[model samples]
Target: MSPRILILGGGYVGMYTALRLQRKLRRGEARVTVIDADSYMTYQPFLPEAAAGNLEPRHVVVPLRRVLNRCTLLSGWATAIDVAGRTVDFSPHRGESRKIEYDVLIVAPGSVSRTLPIPGLAECGIGFKTVEEAIHLRNHVLAQLELAASTTDQAVRREALTFVFVGAGFAGVEALAELEDMAHDALRYYPELKADELRWYLIEATDRILPEVGPEMGRWTLEQLRARGIDVRLGTKLESAKDGRIVLDDGTEFDAATLVWTAGVKPHPIVRHSDLPIDAKGRVKATSRLTVEGVDGVFAAGDCAAVPDLTNPGEYTAPNAQHAVRQTKVLADNVLAHLRGGKMGDYRHAYAGSVASLGLHKGVAQIYGRRLRGPLAWFVHRTYHLSRVPTVNRKVRVLIDWTLALFFRREIVALGALSEPRREFELATRDK
Candidate 1:
């Protein structure tokens, strides 16, 4: 019988692994099955653009059913994995649960937003991780603008136009910058509104922003944001957010209609279901070869696996797309070696530089020990990520979207009505 390879999560790790295996593995050599909460995988790098309405949301995602033709796609969650019993229990949204025995398992469920227990955070804050969240943010922002424009109350208008983003990481910065640019461009439509009336604040607990680009670049990013009139509060944390009112640790308080949280991420909670060896951070422990340490016929990588960094020695690889994409090749190769009774290969690569977009036609990048900024870095950022946006079909679609963007104005038309379209229908037929 052929080996059964079971993979969890359809994020970058799971999707890339399945992509490689389907091409390399021969017919019936191994039966590959992937189970994920969602049937499609989102290319998260374009999420900010999607939120700003610079790119269509659908173009930024890859549909698994259309791409993974050779593998069994299960749309559900992995409730538990009895590693010793060699069976994985799967639960669907609207169906009975079942256990599927597997020869090998790959736990790559990825990460979730690392949030704090600060008051009102759960009720007020929205994360900038997935496509749904991105679109919702866009709608919410536009709704705030509409509210501010239509209202006569100065206090209410001020609160509606105020935007606060906690955590100065890549997601927070990019999303804030992109949306700010969009909102600034949108002010012309509102005759009563002035661009200066919209307030943008980037609050970070640490002293610097864009930690991936190093301190100097982080300072440069700070200067750029400040030049654009953003109120950047460094070394400040969110103390409370009770009732959608934000209170900062440094004795600042305000009511903001939108609160975006993009601080960090913790490994997927699904790892606890299995007896997989985990570290203190709740990440599955794995060796440099992408093999789950001390676990036979099982492997892990990407955000969920704490794969040791051979280049850095003492530390594990950072949870980034660069590492995850490169690790997939090594994982796929090692899996082939395991099937053929050969030794597995080690996964090692030095950290490549990082690039960040600071609004349209503005960016900062550190590449090969060299720093780049402005339009050149922004073009490079778009080009590099566009090259890595999955299949050629998606590549073409995204490229087309970009090309059209140059000739057309951004669509600030928010479809808030889409959320509750049934409201109108229900009211219309209530008497009947």
Candidate 2:
């Protein structure tokens, strides 16, 4: 009988591994099955643009069934992994629990939003992860302007116009810049809303933002943000956010309806529940080749696994898309080698710098030991990401969006009803 291979969480690692195995391994060698909560793999780097109406939300995600045709695709969430019994317990899209036995397992369940205990955050704030959140934020930001313009109440207008973004990382910085640009362009249509009326504040507990791009580039980014009238509050923390009142640790207080939390991410909670060896940071501990330590016939990778960074001594790789994509190639190769009884190579790659977009026609980038800023950097950022955006079909669509954006104004329509799909249903039911 052929050994059954079960790969969990169809993110970068899971999908790539399955695809490679399907191509490398023979039909009777191993039967590969991949399971994920969602059938689509979100290309997260494009999320800020997607949120800013620069790109379509559907284009940012790749359908798993279309890509992984050779492997068996299961739409569900893995609840538990019984390594001892070689069985995984999972819950389907809308069904009861089911268990599947596997001779080999790959646990690559990715990270989730690492929320803090800040007051009212759970109820008020929205995170900048996934396609749903990006679409919701895009609609919400546009709708805020509409609400402010239609209302005559001063307090309501002030509350609706103010926007707060927490965290100074790539997500926070890109999201704030893109949304700010969108809102500014949208205000030309609203006579009552002025650029000054919209308060854009970015709070970061750290002293500097964009640490990935080095200090010089980070400093330049700070200046660009400030020049745009954005309040870049460094070394400040969000102490509380209750009833739309935001309190900073530095004793600043403000009332804002939209609070976006792009603060870091933690390993998915499902990893903790599994009987796998985990690191101090709650990540699955894997060898340099991406195989789970002390677990036979099991491997892991991506944001959820602490794969050793062979290039950097005494440190595991940082969780980022750049590293994830590069690591996935090695992970796939190593998994196939292990199955074929060939020698597996260790994963190692040097840091290749970072790039970040600050709204339209502006960006900061550090690549191959060179620093670039302004329009050149923005162009480089777009060019680099466009080339690396996975499939050729998505690349063409994104390039077309960019081409069209050059000739026309951004789409400012806000479909806020998307967040509450059941609102119309509830209204219709009540009317009946």
lDDT of each: 0.91, 0.90
* Tens-digit per-residue lDDT, 87-156, candidate 2: 9998998979899899889888889999999999998999998999999999998988999999999999
Report residue 320 deviation for candidate 2 (angstroms). 0.4
TM-scores for every candidate against the unseen true structure: 0.98, 0.98
Clash pairs detected, candidate 1: none
Report lDDT (Cα) of residue 382, candidate 2: 88
| Count of backbone collisions in candidate 1 | 0
Candidate 1 regions with alpha-carbon error over 4 angstroms: none
Predicted structure with the largest lDDT when compared to the true one = 1
Q: In order, what is each prediction's RMSD in angstroms?
A: 1.1, 1.2
Q: What is the lDDT of residue 20 in candidate 1?
A: 93
